[model samples]
Target: MFISISIPLADETRVRPYTIASSPEDGDLFEIVFNRVPGGAGVAWLFERKAGDEINFTGPFGAFTLERAPERELVFIAEGTAIAPIRPMLRRVFEQKPGHPVRLLYAADRVEHLLFRGEIEGHAIAHPQFQFETIIADGGQEALYARIMAEVERRWVVTDNDRMRHFYVCGIGAGVLRIRDLLRGAGYERRAVRYEQW
Candidate 1:
């Protein structure tokens, strides 16, 4: 499901490829979530978008997708806006197998900064097989206050069967590095983990 979009050049330079967040059944509109960085062209342009605005993009271009494999558990680890893709992937996963053991660990600076928190909770509450955990890096609350590394390690390697579950981590540069290191330490079998770091 690929479409071309005409995103305005926020930095007067380039229009980056952003995974449209909307599900294919949702129709013609493509939803994307991004933050404005200091010099990020895509984010800058995306920030100025209004309803009815036009943007250009190419693809459906990720090798990563939610394929039904009920025998295997799955884990999604996202930081900040990276949850956009995870959201859709979860939708696909649940649609195919409502009771599959899928864990979502979303890390953010604060609860307010957590994207799709309500939606995550709703899914967890509605489905017994879906589990959701949030780690706040700001330490402003009693909830998991560890960095992503510490928080993520809790579930990286499922010891029950010694079978490394599928792991996906998405975030910025340093955050991605930390996740990779954490997974490596957790004995995740390397190949079972997929990552997308901005």
Candidate 2:
């Protein structure tokens, strides 16, 4: 869903849209992740925030809620910074479906490009039901495809081919769609894969 964050200026306020990264289970506060752009006004404005600073942001609006795929395995694919929205969704899976198998394939150009790397890796370490893989896409398209394909095949070994499955892809622009396509081409139903949208 979309969240409106406002930067208060002397005579006016500027607003930007960011995805909500917290689930209702996370309590009253909603978390959002953003990076500083090279020459971005909003980035500059947001960076000036202090720990106790107050910023104007509104709503956790969206229909991209998590579902209980009890009859199927749940797979999440995230690219670069898309982990922001997927974080709480993944958390919900852990909360609502205790023993279910959940797999996450997150890709970035480099280790430094990954967000919440430690957090996600730590979660996977603590939870045996969840499997995680990181793909460094700097190795070219063919290499990236091979890595993801291997991970998918590995998951298939444990996952029932006859059982239904749901795939969630979250990332910037075409990246998410490309992942969706990969999953679809791998024999998953078109309707089973969901991607983040504008």
Best by TM-score: 1
Q: Whole-model Cα lDDT per candidate?
A: 0.69, 0.73
Residues 1-198 of candidate 1 have per-residue lDDT tens digits of 223345655345564656666687788766776666677665766777788865566666765556654456788888777787777888888777644478888888768879878888988887798889877777532223246665565445443435557787777666676677667667767767777776
Which parts of model 2 are misplaced by more than 4 Å? 7-14, 138-163, 185-187
Judging by lDDT against the true structure, name the best candidate.
Answer: 2
Give the per-residue lDDT of model 2 (tens digit) for 127-190: 8988888888787545655566566656653365642678887765554565667667777788
Off by over 4 Å in 1: 1-12, 39-41, 98-100, 139-146, 157-161
* lDDT over C-alpha atoms for residue 100 of model 2: 66
Candidate 2 achieves a global lDDT of 0.73
lDDT of 1: 0.69
